[model samples]
Target: MQQGGNPNDIFIKINALLEEAKPRFSEECCIYKVPNNIRKLNEDAYTPQVVSIGPFHHANQNLQKMEDQKRLYCRQFIERSETKNLESLVSCVQEMEEEVRSCYSDDIKLSKEEHVMLILVDSCFILEFLLRFYFLVTRGDDSILLPEQLLVHIRNDLLLVENQVPFFVLDKLYYLSFPSTLNGEDLHNHPPLLSLTCYILPGFMISEDNFVLLSVSSDVDFGRIAHFVDLTRKLLLKSSKLFQLSTSDCSREAQVTHIYSASELNELGVKFEVNKNTECLLDITLSGHTLRIPFIRVHDWTELVLRNLLAFEQCHCIHESYLTDYTLFLDFLINTDKDVDLLIKKGIIENWLGDSNAVAKMFNGLAANTVTPDFNVQYSNIFKDLNAFCAHPWNKKVATLKRDYCNTPWKTVASIAAIFLLILTIIQTIFSILQVVH
Candidate 1:
């Protein structure tokens, strides 16, 4: 007992504990596991299916099948990078281990060697894959992405929360592979890092028409990127000034509350039109009684992608949570299956899901545990305008009449005829009253 309680040993243990308590590295904090509370809503959305790029899901048995494949790609990448010394590459990557570790919110459970191996293997695979895949597409030979379905799954896996490697790691490997000494101009003239990603994935096109989707600034620092998900988000919300939180700066004022569904808005004679403008997916403009919304394709992958995006906003970027706000806006717009059907009919929502009810459930489900901030400038004007329009007694009566009677062509004709007769009767009564006065 006396030996175990020695004063010198106790002081040494105390010092070690204190040393571990402080934050260790100065790297920008990003790339996190979906918070457990948020992930619980839809665990499948956050989990990877085909590949695990980082340590979060490295131990998962399901993705172990791809580990050997990852090594194969790693070998190919080393050869392509023309790396003279594999040991130097390892050392370079290892040098940033503390910085890389600081990027993730979770304490990486992998040992130093294992973590470094993960970064090297994964970063090489992604860089090699993106470059080769882009080259294939530009050359009009998609045999690399052929057998289509597998490519689809891989594309889907890359955007999953658990299937991300930090952008820094990827950048290091990329520059090392294609060194800058002889290729300085290539760095400035190279297509966006997202070009291959966009080309591989649907909904994004690298056309001049959609510069917002493919326009990657050469001057923008790659180190600023958290992961693939962050890049995707940056593309989607191209204008941060609009959705970023502001109180005094917001010109559009609104209360944080739900509005009528798409069906209700339709009955109110508020037309829902597909947005022709390609500014942003969440850019919803309400001009007079018409709500112009960009069409969003809903497929098997849509739910997972949207949920993870929302989760990322919740965990890291709560103040600038445009995706969450957009989902909440949609939740209000789509309260029921009837609302979903209304949007589908109007081309505002391209629902590829098997059941319309599932789309309804998803939109409604997205708002779970969300507390909408009142002064969301991007949508506040739209919300306020809609509410003011809906609040008028005349609009409510017209909507009620349309839902109750003016549903069919025959009913609409009958309503017009009845109104005409009522007007004619009033005119006739006025003429009789004038005759009596004369």
Candidate 2:
């Protein structure tokens, strides 16, 4: 019996362990912990700074200071909600606890009561925050977002892949909070949550001219959206006919072998121009010798937003990583500050960070830990065409000649003078030969 180790006891222990080891992932799972390989490059970009929304960062002591704020928002949300009582909201979340748990990639360790409470408070906070933001923008009302720095931090935190609740949770809470809006009386005053979300994240719009705030319709299915990150991705790709049409044909096994930098392309007679035809930043196009790219603003929080989006695509999107592909394309075109400067001068990039080197570094660092599966279809044709154009003997010779003799006005004049002198000397020699023959 060796230390009273019984067969039945061992069997029971093994059975319990097996139960715990069952798969936690579901088809609904979208919210993910940013992979360490990606997060290690810049932890602050992926980690929530002032607030934690979901289960992944719920236990972080650094984020606990925001707990009071969360409760306060939740209270305000309830006070203004149509239900006007806490119990209804609590019940709604409690009913969806299992489904909500399935939405997260990691197994939530909180007990049912704790999990429900977490979801309730976080969801209400987000809903209320968006509502206030909407009123502030549309009616000039003051809001907690009045503090510019805090607003920036909150925007960054809310967009982080790790710091998100399911969008459906927010949607359900939103409708429940404003039941009368469904009947159309207060519909104008209370826009859908998605529209308010767009207002708060204006940077993702790329161009205001083409960014349409989502309206609730049969075409707009809120159920499919996993979280704010997914919504942002959708918003980005919504207007890109190129992406919409080509995504299905894109091959995941292909890779982009090579492409020249912006300066290199310029040297090869390739012109870069600001694309005015489309608002989607991903709708980059190449025609003849010109490359047209939509304008993108780079600011303090740009990297933070992009890194999170990149991480989300890496973790979830299997077939179409549009954002990832776009990022890799930019990385291929920008290798140094010179490339950034070239793009800035061409109006492709609005560098608000004010440092070209920093912008270059940001683009270069974006694709460090990510994989571009559909790179071949996404921009492989452009690379192929550019390489073919650049490789032509005539093109290279012309480029070389320009570099050697015509790069400056003084050099151009000197070369022209030398050529004229050579022609004159050749004519003189021919005349001298004729004289000798005579």
Candidate 3:
């Protein structure tokens, strides 16, 4: 095996298998749940459920307000399902949402936005779980259709929702949005106990950094979310400005480009200049297509991209790992030099990338097992592709700039260490001079 080559190769093979496996599975094979609090089914083997908060509310206002008014709702969806098919999982939840809505009196006066938001919040957990499952199956695959399929799934599901709802009301709900409040904890660290649930569409984004991560499909698109999480970490590590600019610019152009589904409507990708004129272009590769969106700033596009994402937190998930891994991937890619070249040349650097230490601590909180080396192997393959892309002279220059100038605050902390040491020595000399004079 050539350094990271074995793992890379293994990941590629596994990814290929996952692609074949996904469509074969059905929603009937998956089951999910939603609850007000963390529920434990087993005492010995406990799984900390991944939960999310959005702008809408279905049940339990106290828990909702305690987090953030802007948090649409705490979405707890399917983190793990016996069925691997994300489409199947989404289908089940959509059925459940329709059932619940139909059970209510037809006379119950509910606005279209209110009804959809309610459905979205209820299904939130399921969407989360489905997305997680997709992540688990396709983690190492790097399959292009992963994100594309996810987008199509979201579009189809939304069409179903539209089919079920009164068209006039659905139209009003589509445009209705509220201002987001940034009050909340980093629940990414603290895993909650919850059941498989899915949220109705509560569309919004983290407007600042433009790291858009919303599930527009009741069926979660694991590939796109993972990519988004990775992209976000890069932005957060880079100057928040660069992250915002790159993503926003790409998003604006993306809107003008192709959008086969709502998920594609929120395509996320990395964009950089290939020439001296800094001819900016959008790489929507992560969006699951090879088409390059030209004539837009990657930065400005992220805002629109992320904004579209926020418009649909309609997907589902159950495991914190799904979201956390996505976050960790982002952090690792952004904070460390673990891109295509570094991984290809040096292979995997265990415990060097991302906030692995912090993630480890977080895992401890869940009493979870350490991530296996096998998992690392898969990620190494992703770096292989990245390395190939970066091997280009222009990409090399951009990567270098990202490494030195665009990293997060923690990476920059090393620069201050020497300054601190210099200050300490100066203070000691001053003390020595004062004592001798006295």
lDDT top scorer: 2
Q: Model 3 scores what on Cα lDDT?
A: 0.30
Ten-residue stretch with the least lDDT total in model 1 = 204-213
- Candidate 2 per-residue C-alpha lDDT over 1-438 given as tens digits, one digit per residue, 9 for 90 to 100: 557789899999999998888676688789988888888999889888899998999999998888998888889889888779788888999999999999888878899999999999999999888888778643233335767787778878899999999988998888888988756668677876767776656464534434443343224568888888887777676667576633575455566667889988888788999998878888788998899998898988889988888888888984578788888889989999999999999989999998999999999999897876556375777777888889999889888888899888999999999999999999999999999999
Tell me the TM-score of model 1. Answer: 0.84
User: lDDT per residue, candidate 3, 1-438, as tens digits?
Assistant: 655658888999999998876332233211112111221322211111112222112233433432331122222222232223435434443545443344322222555555545444434433333344334334443222256554333322221211122222211111121101112232242111111112212112122212222222122322222222222223232322212322432121111111121111112223321222211121112322222222222121222232222111112222111222222333333322223222223222223224434323322233122131112222233334444444557755755654674466765576467668899999999999999999
- Local error of candidate 2 at residue 204 (angstroms): 4.8
Off by over 4 Å in 3: 1-172, 176-360, 366-438
The best candidate by TM-score is 2
Q: Which stretches of candidate 1 lie over 4 Å from their true place?
A: 1-27, 137-146, 180-182, 185-194, 200-219, 239-255, 371-375, 424-438
Residue lDDT tens for model 1, 44-130: 888887788888898899988777867876776687664556786798899988888888777888889988988988887777678
* TM-score list, all predictions: 0.84, 0.90, 0.21
How does residue 210 of candidate 1 score in lDDT? 58
User: Once model 1 is optimally superposed onto the true structure by TM-score, how far is the C-alpha of residue 59 displaced, in angstroms?
Assistant: 0.7
Q: How accurate locally, in lDDT, is each candidate?
A: 0.73, 0.82, 0.30
Clashing pairs in 2: none
